[model samples]
Target: MTNDSPKPDDDAVRARVIEAADRLYYAYGVQAIGMDTLRTEAGVSLKRLYRLFPSKESILEQVLLHRHDMWNGLVERAIEGGEPRERLLAIYDMLARWFDEDDFRGCVFINCFGELGTTTPRVAEIVRTHKAGFQARLAELVAEAGGPQSLAPQLAILAEGAQTTAAIAGTNDAARQARQAAEVLIDAALGPATGTAQTRTSTTVTTARPAFRSRR
Candidate 1:
Protein backbone atom coordinates (compact mmCIF):
# COMPACT_ATOMS: atom_id res chain seq x y z
CA MET A 1 0.00 0.00 0.00
CA THR A 2 1.24 3.48 -0.88
CA ASN A 3 0.55 6.36 1.56
CA ASP A 4 -0.43 9.58 -0.20
CA SER A 5 0.22 12.95 1.46
CA PRO A 6 0.54 16.44 -0.06
CA LYS A 7 4.11 17.49 -0.55
CA PRO A 8 5.28 21.07 0.12
CA ASP A 9 5.71 23.34 -2.89
CA ASP A 10 9.38 23.45 -3.81
CA ASP A 11 9.12 26.83 -5.51
CA ALA A 12 7.35 28.40 -2.58
CA VAL A 13 9.82 26.85 -0.15
CA ARG A 14 12.74 28.11 -2.24
CA ALA A 15 11.27 31.61 -2.35
CA ARG A 16 10.82 31.61 1.42
CA VAL A 17 14.41 30.60 1.93
CA ILE A 18 15.65 33.29 -0.43
CA GLU A 19 13.43 35.98 1.07
CA ALA A 20 14.47 35.06 4.61
CA ALA A 21 18.11 34.98 3.56
CA ASP A 22 17.85 38.37 1.88
CA ARG A 23 16.47 39.98 5.01
CA LEU A 24 18.89 38.24 7.35
CA TYR A 25 21.91 38.88 5.13
CA TYR A 26 20.97 42.51 4.68
CA ALA A 27 20.54 43.07 8.41
CA TYR A 28 23.60 41.03 9.38
CA GLY A 29 26.54 40.28 7.14
CA VAL A 30 26.06 37.07 5.16
CA GLN A 31 28.93 35.22 6.76
CA ALA A 32 27.60 35.95 10.23
CA ILE A 33 24.33 34.09 9.66
CA GLY A 34 24.53 30.28 9.70
CA MET A 35 22.29 27.67 8.10
CA ASP A 36 20.47 26.93 11.38
CA THR A 37 19.45 30.57 11.75
CA LEU A 38 18.39 30.70 8.12
CA ARG A 39 16.29 27.57 8.51
CA THR A 40 14.59 29.00 11.57
CA GLU A 41 14.02 32.35 9.89
CA ALA A 42 12.64 30.68 6.80
CA GLY A 43 10.39 28.54 9.00
CA VAL A 44 11.50 25.46 7.09
CA SER A 45 12.72 22.18 8.45
CA LEU A 46 16.50 21.79 8.32
CA LYS A 47 15.97 18.74 6.11
CA ARG A 48 13.85 20.73 3.67
CA LEU A 49 16.26 23.67 3.70
CA TYR A 50 19.17 21.42 2.93
CA ARG A 51 17.16 19.70 0.26
CA LEU A 52 16.47 23.06 -1.45
CA PHE A 53 19.93 24.58 -0.99
CA PRO A 54 22.86 22.32 -0.24
CA SER A 55 24.90 25.16 1.24
CA LYS A 56 24.69 28.75 2.46
CA GLU A 57 26.46 29.94 -0.67
CA SER A 58 23.75 28.41 -2.83
CA ILE A 59 21.07 30.22 -0.85
CA LEU A 60 23.00 33.50 -1.10
CA GLU A 61 23.27 33.13 -4.86
CA GLN A 62 19.51 32.77 -5.15
CA VAL A 63 19.00 35.80 -2.88
CA LEU A 64 21.21 37.97 -5.07
CA LEU A 65 19.37 36.85 -8.17
CA HIS A 66 16.07 37.72 -6.52
CA ARG A 67 17.43 41.12 -5.56
CA HIS A 68 18.48 41.74 -9.16
CA ASP A 69 14.96 41.09 -10.38
CA MET A 70 13.56 43.42 -7.68
CA TRP A 71 15.98 46.20 -8.51
CA ASN A 72 15.21 46.00 -12.22
CA GLY A 73 11.47 46.03 -11.58
CA LEU A 74 11.85 49.10 -9.35
CA VAL A 75 13.70 51.08 -12.01
CA GLU A 76 11.26 50.07 -14.71
CA ARG A 77 8.29 51.15 -12.61
CA ALA A 78 9.92 54.45 -11.62
CA ILE A 79 10.71 55.46 -15.20
CA GLU A 80 7.49 54.30 -16.77
CA GLY A 81 5.28 56.76 -18.69
CA GLY A 82 7.82 59.57 -18.59
CA GLU A 83 9.64 61.48 -21.32
CA PRO A 84 13.31 60.55 -21.69
CA ARG A 85 14.52 63.44 -19.52
CA GLU A 86 11.87 62.78 -16.89
CA ARG A 87 12.74 59.10 -16.97
CA LEU A 88 16.38 59.91 -16.25
CA LEU A 89 15.47 62.17 -13.33
CA ALA A 90 12.94 59.63 -12.10
CA ILE A 91 15.85 57.40 -11.09
CA TYR A 92 16.81 59.95 -8.46
CA ASP A 93 13.19 60.29 -7.38
CA MET A 94 13.13 56.55 -6.83
CA LEU A 95 16.37 56.75 -4.86
CA ALA A 96 14.95 59.47 -2.62
CA ARG A 97 11.98 57.32 -1.68
CA TRP A 98 14.19 54.32 -1.05
CA PHE A 99 16.59 56.26 1.17
CA ASP A 100 13.74 57.48 3.36
CA GLU A 101 12.63 53.97 4.30
CA ASP A 102 13.25 53.09 7.97
CA ASP A 103 15.06 49.89 7.05
CA PHE A 104 17.14 51.54 4.34
CA ARG A 105 20.60 50.04 4.17
CA GLY A 106 23.15 50.62 1.43
CA CYS A 107 22.95 48.76 -1.86
CA VAL A 108 22.83 45.01 -1.14
CA PHE A 109 25.28 44.38 -3.98
CA ILE A 110 27.76 46.88 -2.58
CA ASN A 111 27.33 45.56 0.94
CA CYS A 112 27.71 41.96 -0.15
CA PHE A 113 30.70 42.84 -2.29
CA GLY A 114 32.46 44.40 0.65
CA GLU A 115 31.66 41.35 2.75
CA LEU A 116 32.37 38.50 0.30
CA GLY A 117 33.72 39.76 -3.02
CA THR A 118 37.36 39.27 -2.06
CA THR A 119 36.98 35.63 -1.03
CA THR A 120 34.06 34.66 -3.27
CA PRO A 121 34.47 35.01 -7.02
CA ARG A 122 30.82 34.34 -7.71
CA VAL A 123 29.63 37.18 -5.47
CA ALA A 124 32.02 39.58 -7.15
CA GLU A 125 30.85 38.53 -10.59
CA ILE A 126 27.20 38.94 -9.67
CA VAL A 127 27.90 42.45 -8.35
CA ARG A 128 29.80 43.40 -11.48
CA THR A 129 26.96 42.07 -13.64
CA HIS A 130 24.33 43.99 -11.65
CA LYS A 131 26.27 47.27 -11.94
CA ALA A 132 26.98 46.79 -15.63
CA GLY A 133 23.31 46.10 -16.20
CA PHE A 134 22.41 49.41 -14.54
CA GLN A 135 24.98 51.30 -16.57
CA ALA A 136 23.70 49.71 -19.78
CA ARG A 137 20.17 50.74 -18.89
CA LEU A 138 21.38 54.27 -18.27
CA ALA A 139 23.15 54.26 -21.63
CA GLU A 140 19.90 53.35 -23.35
CA LEU A 141 18.12 56.17 -21.49
CA VAL A 142 20.83 58.68 -22.38
CA ALA A 143 20.64 57.69 -26.05
CA GLU A 144 16.87 58.12 -26.01
CA ALA A 145 17.25 61.55 -24.41
CA GLY A 146 19.68 62.63 -27.17
CA GLY A 147 22.55 62.88 -24.70
CA PRO A 148 25.98 61.55 -25.60
CA GLN A 149 26.87 58.05 -24.39
CA SER A 150 29.53 59.54 -22.13
CA LEU A 151 26.80 61.16 -20.04
CA ALA A 152 25.41 57.80 -18.92
CA PRO A 153 28.54 56.83 -16.99
CA GLN A 154 28.63 60.20 -15.28
CA LEU A 155 25.00 59.86 -14.23
CA ALA A 156 25.63 56.31 -13.08
CA ILE A 157 28.51 57.51 -10.93
CA LEU A 158 26.31 60.17 -9.32
CA ALA A 159 23.67 57.57 -8.51
CA GLU A 160 26.28 55.15 -7.16
CA GLY A 161 27.93 57.83 -5.05
CA ALA A 162 24.59 58.97 -3.69
CA GLN A 163 23.78 55.46 -2.47
CA THR A 164 27.09 55.19 -0.61
CA THR A 165 26.83 58.67 0.82
CA ALA A 166 23.26 58.20 1.97
CA ALA A 167 24.13 54.94 3.67
CA ILE A 168 27.13 56.41 5.45
CA ALA A 169 25.55 59.72 6.36
CA GLY A 170 22.21 58.21 7.41
CA THR A 171 20.21 60.82 5.57
CA ASN A 172 18.03 60.97 2.47
CA ASP A 173 19.46 64.42 1.55
CA ALA A 174 22.03 62.79 -0.68
CA ALA A 175 19.33 61.97 -3.19
CA ARG A 176 18.33 65.63 -3.53
CA GLN A 177 21.97 66.70 -3.77
CA ALA A 178 22.68 64.06 -6.39
CA ARG A 179 19.55 65.05 -8.30
CA GLN A 180 20.70 68.68 -8.38
CA ALA A 181 24.10 67.67 -9.72
CA ALA A 182 22.44 65.35 -12.23
CA GLU A 183 20.33 68.21 -13.55
CA VAL A 184 23.49 70.20 -14.29
CA LEU A 185 25.12 67.25 -16.01
CA ILE A 186 22.01 66.50 -18.06
CA ASP A 187 21.63 70.13 -19.19
CA ALA A 188 25.28 70.40 -20.17
CA ALA A 189 25.11 67.17 -22.16
CA LEU A 190 21.94 68.21 -24.00
CA GLY A 191 23.37 71.72 -24.51
CA PRO A 192 21.52 75.04 -24.55
CA ALA A 193 19.67 74.29 -27.78
CA THR A 194 17.82 71.36 -26.25
CA GLY A 195 17.81 72.18 -22.52
CA THR A 196 14.82 73.91 -20.94
CA ALA A 197 15.29 77.52 -19.79
CA GLN A 198 14.49 76.49 -16.20
CA THR A 199 17.16 73.81 -16.13
CA ARG A 200 19.64 76.23 -17.69
CA THR A 201 18.90 78.82 -15.00
CA SER A 202 19.05 76.25 -12.20
CA THR A 203 22.50 75.10 -13.29
CA THR A 204 23.90 78.59 -12.77
CA VAL A 205 22.86 78.75 -9.10
CA THR A 206 25.07 77.31 -6.36
CA THR A 207 23.75 74.30 -4.39
CA ALA A 208 24.35 74.38 -0.65
CA ARG A 209 25.77 71.29 1.02
CA PRO A 210 23.90 69.52 3.78
CA ALA A 211 25.44 69.42 7.25
CA PHE A 212 26.76 66.03 8.29
CA ARG A 213 25.77 64.24 11.48
CA SER A 214 27.06 60.93 12.77
CA ARG A 215 24.40 58.23 12.82
CA ARG A 216 26.19 56.29 15.52
Candidate 2:
Protein backbone atom coordinates (compact mmCIF):
# COMPACT_ATOMS: atom_id res chain seq x y z
CA MET A 1 0.00 0.00 0.00
CA THR A 2 1.18 3.50 -0.80
CA ASN A 3 1.94 5.72 2.16
CA ASP A 4 -1.07 7.56 3.52
CA SER A 5 1.05 9.29 6.12
CA PRO A 6 3.21 12.50 5.97
CA LYS A 7 0.60 14.31 3.91
CA PRO A 8 -1.17 17.46 5.14
CA ASP A 9 -4.51 15.65 4.80
CA ASP A 10 -7.21 13.88 6.73
CA ASP A 11 -5.89 10.33 6.41
CA ALA A 12 -2.38 11.36 7.33
CA VAL A 13 -3.54 13.18 10.42
CA ARG A 14 -5.81 10.33 11.40
CA ALA A 15 -3.12 7.74 10.87
CA ARG A 16 -0.73 9.69 13.06
CA VAL A 17 -3.41 10.05 15.71
CA ILE A 18 -3.99 6.32 15.62
CA GLU A 19 -0.30 5.55 15.86
CA ALA A 20 0.04 7.79 18.92
CA ALA A 21 -3.10 6.34 20.46
CA ASP A 22 -1.74 2.86 19.90
CA ARG A 23 1.50 3.79 21.59
CA LEU A 24 -0.30 5.40 24.51
CA TYR A 25 -2.52 2.41 25.10
CA TYR A 26 0.34 -0.06 24.72
CA ALA A 27 2.64 2.03 26.89
CA TYR A 28 0.11 3.17 29.47
CA GLY A 29 -3.49 1.93 29.44
CA VAL A 30 -6.54 2.53 27.28
CA GLN A 31 -8.42 4.62 29.83
CA ALA A 32 -5.36 6.69 30.51
CA ILE A 33 -5.31 8.52 27.18
CA GLY A 34 -7.74 11.25 26.11
CA MET A 35 -8.73 12.78 22.78
CA ASP A 36 -7.06 16.14 23.43
CA THR A 37 -3.73 14.45 24.11
CA LEU A 38 -4.07 12.32 21.03
CA ARG A 39 -4.87 15.31 18.88
CA THR A 40 -1.88 17.14 20.23
CA GLU A 41 0.30 14.16 19.54
CA ALA A 42 -1.00 13.94 16.00
CA GLY A 43 -0.52 17.71 15.50
CA VAL A 44 -4.05 17.87 14.16
CA SER A 45 -6.84 20.27 14.99
CA LEU A 46 -9.82 19.20 17.11
CA LYS A 47 -12.08 19.43 14.07
CA ARG A 48 -9.80 17.09 12.14
CA LEU A 49 -9.73 14.66 15.04
CA TYR A 50 -13.53 14.58 15.15
CA ARG A 51 -13.67 14.20 11.41
CA LEU A 52 -11.48 11.12 11.76
CA PHE A 53 -12.84 9.50 14.92
CA PRO A 54 -16.04 11.25 16.02
CA SER A 55 -15.23 10.67 19.69
CA LYS A 56 -12.69 9.26 22.13
CA GLU A 57 -14.62 6.01 22.42
CA SER A 58 -14.73 5.75 18.67
CA ILE A 59 -10.99 6.17 18.47
CA LEU A 60 -10.48 3.55 21.16
CA GLU A 61 -12.66 1.15 19.23
CA GLN A 62 -10.57 1.73 16.12
CA VAL A 63 -7.43 1.16 18.14
CA LEU A 64 -8.84 -2.22 19.09
CA LEU A 65 -9.84 -2.97 15.53
CA HIS A 66 -6.34 -2.08 14.40
CA ARG A 67 -4.89 -4.45 16.96
CA HIS A 68 -7.30 -7.18 15.90
CA ASP A 69 -6.31 -6.93 12.26
CA MET A 70 -2.58 -6.97 13.00
CA TRP A 71 -2.87 -9.99 15.28
CA ASN A 72 -5.29 -11.79 13.00
CA GLY A 73 -2.81 -11.39 10.17
CA LEU A 74 -0.09 -12.96 12.31
CA VAL A 75 -2.37 -15.87 13.21
CA GLU A 76 -3.55 -16.34 9.65
CA ARG A 77 0.00 -16.41 8.35
CA ALA A 78 0.97 -18.99 10.97
CA ILE A 79 -2.08 -21.11 10.23
CA GLU A 80 -1.46 -20.95 6.50
CA GLY A 81 1.88 -22.79 6.69
CA GLY A 82 1.10 -25.61 9.10
CA GLU A 83 -0.68 -28.95 9.33
CA PRO A 84 -3.59 -29.19 11.73
CA ARG A 85 -1.53 -30.27 14.76
CA GLU A 86 1.34 -28.01 13.83
CA ARG A 87 -1.13 -25.18 13.28
CA LEU A 88 -2.35 -25.59 16.83
CA LEU A 89 1.23 -25.29 18.06
CA ALA A 90 1.68 -22.24 15.87
CA ILE A 91 -0.75 -20.32 18.05
CA TYR A 92 1.21 -21.15 21.19
CA ASP A 93 4.46 -20.45 19.41
CA MET A 94 3.21 -17.04 18.39
CA LEU A 95 2.22 -16.33 21.97
CA ALA A 96 5.65 -17.45 23.09
CA ARG A 97 7.29 -14.83 20.89
CA TRP A 98 4.83 -12.19 22.03
CA PHE A 99 5.45 -13.02 25.67
CA ASP A 100 9.14 -12.46 25.09
CA GLU A 101 8.57 -8.98 23.67
CA ASP A 102 9.37 -6.32 26.27
CA ASP A 103 6.23 -4.29 25.60
CA PHE A 104 3.83 -7.21 25.38
CA ARG A 105 0.66 -6.54 27.40
CA GLY A 106 -1.49 -9.59 26.75
CA CYS A 107 -4.67 -9.63 24.64
CA VAL A 108 -5.89 -6.20 23.57
CA PHE A 109 -9.50 -7.38 23.32
CA ILE A 110 -9.47 -8.44 26.96
CA ASN A 111 -7.97 -5.10 27.97
CA CYS A 112 -10.51 -3.32 25.81
CA PHE A 113 -13.33 -5.32 27.40
CA GLY A 114 -12.42 -3.73 30.73
CA GLU A 115 -11.79 -0.30 29.19
CA LEU A 116 -14.96 -0.44 27.08
CA GLY A 117 -17.53 -0.05 29.88
CA THR A 118 -21.07 0.43 28.38
CA THR A 119 -20.41 3.11 25.82
CA THR A 120 -21.41 1.58 22.50
CA PRO A 121 -22.90 -1.78 21.69
CA ARG A 122 -21.26 -1.67 18.28
CA VAL A 123 -17.79 -1.48 19.76
CA ALA A 124 -18.66 -4.24 22.19
CA GLU A 125 -19.95 -6.33 19.33
CA ILE A 126 -16.66 -5.90 17.46
CA VAL A 127 -14.69 -7.09 20.47
CA ARG A 128 -17.00 -10.08 20.93
CA THR A 129 -16.73 -10.97 17.26
CA HIS A 130 -12.93 -10.98 17.38
CA LYS A 131 -12.86 -13.21 20.45
CA ALA A 132 -15.52 -15.54 19.14
CA GLY A 133 -13.61 -15.85 15.87
CA PHE A 134 -10.43 -16.73 17.75
CA GLN A 135 -12.16 -19.39 19.81
CA ALA A 136 -13.90 -20.83 16.77
CA ARG A 137 -10.58 -20.98 14.96
CA LEU A 138 -9.08 -22.80 17.94
CA ALA A 139 -11.94 -25.30 17.89
CA GLU A 140 -11.48 -25.85 14.17
CA LEU A 141 -7.75 -26.36 14.51
CA VAL A 142 -8.27 -28.78 17.39
CA ALA A 143 -10.70 -30.82 15.32
CA GLU A 144 -8.35 -30.74 12.34
CA ALA A 145 -5.42 -31.82 14.51
CA GLY A 146 -7.42 -34.71 16.01
CA GLY A 147 -7.72 -33.35 19.54
CA PRO A 148 -10.46 -34.52 21.89
CA GLN A 149 -13.78 -33.18 20.70
CA SER A 150 -15.39 -32.66 24.07
CA LEU A 151 -12.49 -30.57 25.35
CA ALA A 152 -11.99 -28.06 22.54
CA PRO A 153 -14.23 -25.43 24.06
CA GLN A 154 -12.83 -26.11 27.50
CA LEU A 155 -9.34 -25.77 26.12
CA ALA A 156 -10.25 -22.50 24.47
CA ILE A 157 -11.46 -21.17 27.79
CA LEU A 158 -8.26 -22.36 29.43
CA ALA A 159 -6.13 -20.68 26.78
CA GLU A 160 -7.91 -17.36 27.23
CA GLY A 161 -7.51 -17.57 30.99
CA ALA A 162 -3.84 -18.36 30.57
CA GLN A 163 -3.38 -15.35 28.28
CA THR A 164 -5.01 -13.10 30.86
CA THR A 165 -2.99 -14.60 33.66
CA ALA A 166 0.23 -14.33 31.69
CA ALA A 167 -0.44 -10.68 30.96
CA ILE A 168 -1.03 -9.95 34.62
CA ALA A 169 1.99 -11.97 35.58
CA GLY A 170 4.06 -10.18 32.85
CA THR A 171 6.75 -12.82 32.94
CA ASN A 172 8.17 -15.49 30.69
CA ASP A 173 7.60 -17.99 33.47
CA ALA A 174 3.86 -17.39 33.30
CA ALA A 175 3.91 -17.85 29.52
CA ARG A 176 5.77 -21.13 29.96
CA GLN A 177 3.07 -22.33 32.33
CA ALA A 178 0.44 -21.48 29.75
CA ARG A 179 2.33 -23.37 27.05
CA GLN A 180 2.82 -26.43 29.24
CA ALA A 181 -0.82 -26.48 30.28
CA ALA A 182 -1.73 -26.28 26.61
CA GLU A 183 0.49 -29.29 25.83
CA VAL A 184 -1.03 -31.30 28.69
CA LEU A 185 -4.50 -30.50 27.50
CA ILE A 186 -3.54 -31.58 23.98
CA ASP A 187 -1.86 -34.73 25.28
CA ALA A 188 -5.03 -35.63 27.16
CA ALA A 189 -6.74 -34.96 23.87
CA LEU A 190 -4.27 -36.83 21.62
CA GLY A 191 -5.15 -37.10 17.94
CA PRO A 192 -8.26 -39.22 17.38
CA ALA A 193 -8.03 -42.00 14.81
CA THR A 194 -11.38 -41.47 13.09
CA GLY A 195 -11.86 -38.81 10.47
CA THR A 196 -14.30 -37.08 12.79
CA ALA A 197 -13.81 -35.95 16.39
CA GLN A 198 -15.46 -38.00 19.15
CA THR A 199 -17.13 -35.94 21.84
CA ARG A 200 -17.61 -37.63 25.22
CA THR A 201 -20.45 -36.77 27.56
CA SER A 202 -21.22 -37.95 31.09
CA THR A 203 -23.55 -36.80 33.83
CA THR A 204 -21.85 -36.02 37.08
CA VAL A 205 -22.58 -33.75 40.06
CA THR A 206 -19.63 -31.62 40.95
CA THR A 207 -18.95 -28.64 43.17
CA ALA A 208 -17.03 -25.59 41.94
CA ARG A 209 -13.46 -25.23 43.10
CA PRO A 210 -12.75 -21.74 44.43
CA ALA A 211 -9.39 -21.85 42.73
CA PHE A 212 -11.09 -22.18 39.36
CA ARG A 213 -13.47 -19.21 39.69
CA SER A 214 -13.16 -16.48 37.11
CA ARG A 215 -11.00 -13.53 38.08
CA ARG A 216 -13.14 -11.25 36.02
Error of 2 at 90 (Å): 2.1
Deviation (Å) of 201 in candidate 1: 27
True-structure lDDT of candidate 2: 0.67
Candidate 1 matches the true fold with a TM-score of: 0.85
Candidates in order, TM-scores: namely 0.85, 0.76
Model-by-model lDDT, in order? 0.81, 0.67
Per-model clash counts, in order, read 0, 0
Clash pairs, candidate 2, are: none
Clashing pairs in 1: none
Off by over 4 Å in 1: 1-8, 192-216
Query: Model 2, stretches more than 4 Å misplaced?
Result: 1-8, 118-120, 191-216
Give the winner by TM-score. Answer: 1
